[model samples]
Target: QSYIFYGPTMSPFTAYLIIRGISTLEIRIRQQEKNALKVAQFLENHPKVERVYFPGLDSHPQRDLVKKQMHGTGSVLSFVIKGGYAAGETMVNNVELVTLAVSLGCVESLIEHPASMTHSELSPEERKKSGINDSLIRLSVGLEDAEDIIDDLKRAFEKV
Candidate 1:
């Protein structure tokens, strides 16, 4: 019963899994960053995207500082849709390949609407103050083929 209350140690299999993950961490991260940059570029030029918040993009306000401080821009990015909250929801709903989830930095692409999902508890004013607009959408780019990710987002954008 005491053992059940709190595990004395993690399983060997779990430890092995952790080690295996660490072994490929660098490779996976490189691929994820590459994919994220491609996706960010696409979103930056997309008509439906009001603004893309990826530091890798030349248009990003902090692009110079980001380049100075970071090797890669990172796998997660956020954007504001041209339409409002409903547009964000509709686009996310229409995605075929990207999964809708609040969790990020996984092996698979994930998308979320902060206003309605992660930061839903905040009042409109509070959300606005935090720069989480109604049309804001966050995406965690994965290791999937960049074209496929762009295609998936293109299809979703059409619905907005």
Candidate 2:
């Protein structure tokens, strides 16, 4: 597909890099998952967080299904801040360690606001139908120590 625009296929060196990544993928995922669960729990109990939506959490609506089919919950989560768009913007702006980025699934933590970022093109009704909100924030946990991530979040929360 579209091989001419890109290449006939991936170069040998790129394939080798992907193969190398595959070797440690599982370990990386597990560590990210662990960090995510901790981050989720912290958010769930925080006064500033209105709701947390990580499948690893006991409070997750699909917890039963998650347990049945998944060995571990992946490292991404979405949550609602107690305040709306302004608060979301403040927290993201204040982040010192976590990066405010649209790209995720990385070695470093990343955060984004779907209402204004990924789903910005959608109209109000469309956004409502898709469940994206002014306060909704997505976080992709990374390889950092869980405490460090929490501390970064706490600093951000103080601004909100």
Candidate 3:
């Protein structure tokens, strides 16, 4: 019973194209999740990584629950650095491919430190309780080839 109430400027072909792309969002997410799990696995074994946290990892505390309830891992994951806050900052600044930015769920990868970026305004005690530590680096994997993504990350570690 829903009617298509588009403007005269909107061509039927263009409208249908937009609708088709929107409808594939779920499919796109599944593919991205699969790609992300592969990247997470690579990072986990990398010598520079102190810890990798992805819901797909069996070592992750919520892995089973996430697998049961979620269709995908949602493309974003966080990890802690061995040297803590300073090391995280070094990696963020040294990375060439991945951008440093807030927000997620995009077609391009992004990295950010919540304690100094998004949650910078929070009080020290609030940040601690929330587990948004200065040493944490959050990555939102994108459509790029996973090898290239991991290579860029490894390059960043060289500078850190």
Q: Candidate 2: how large is its RMSD? A: 3.4
Q: Would you estimate the TM-scores of all the predictions?
A: 0.92, 0.90, 0.82
Q: TM-score for candidate 2, please give it.
A: 0.90
lDDT by residue (1-160, candidate 2, tens digit) is 4544654788899999999999999999999999999999999999999999999999998999999999999999999998887888787878888999999889899999887788889986788898888889999999999999999999999989
Off by over 4 Å in 2: 1-7
Candidate 3: misplaced stretches above 4 Å? 1-17
Which TM-score value belongs to model 1?
0.92
| lDDT per residue as tens, model 1, 1-160 | 3555564688899999999999999999999999999999999988888999988889999989998999887899999998898998898889989999999989899999998898899998999999889999999999899899999999998878
Q: In angstroms, how far off is 19's CA in candidate 1?
A: 0.9
Clashing pairs in 1: none
Better of 2 and 3 by lDDT: 2
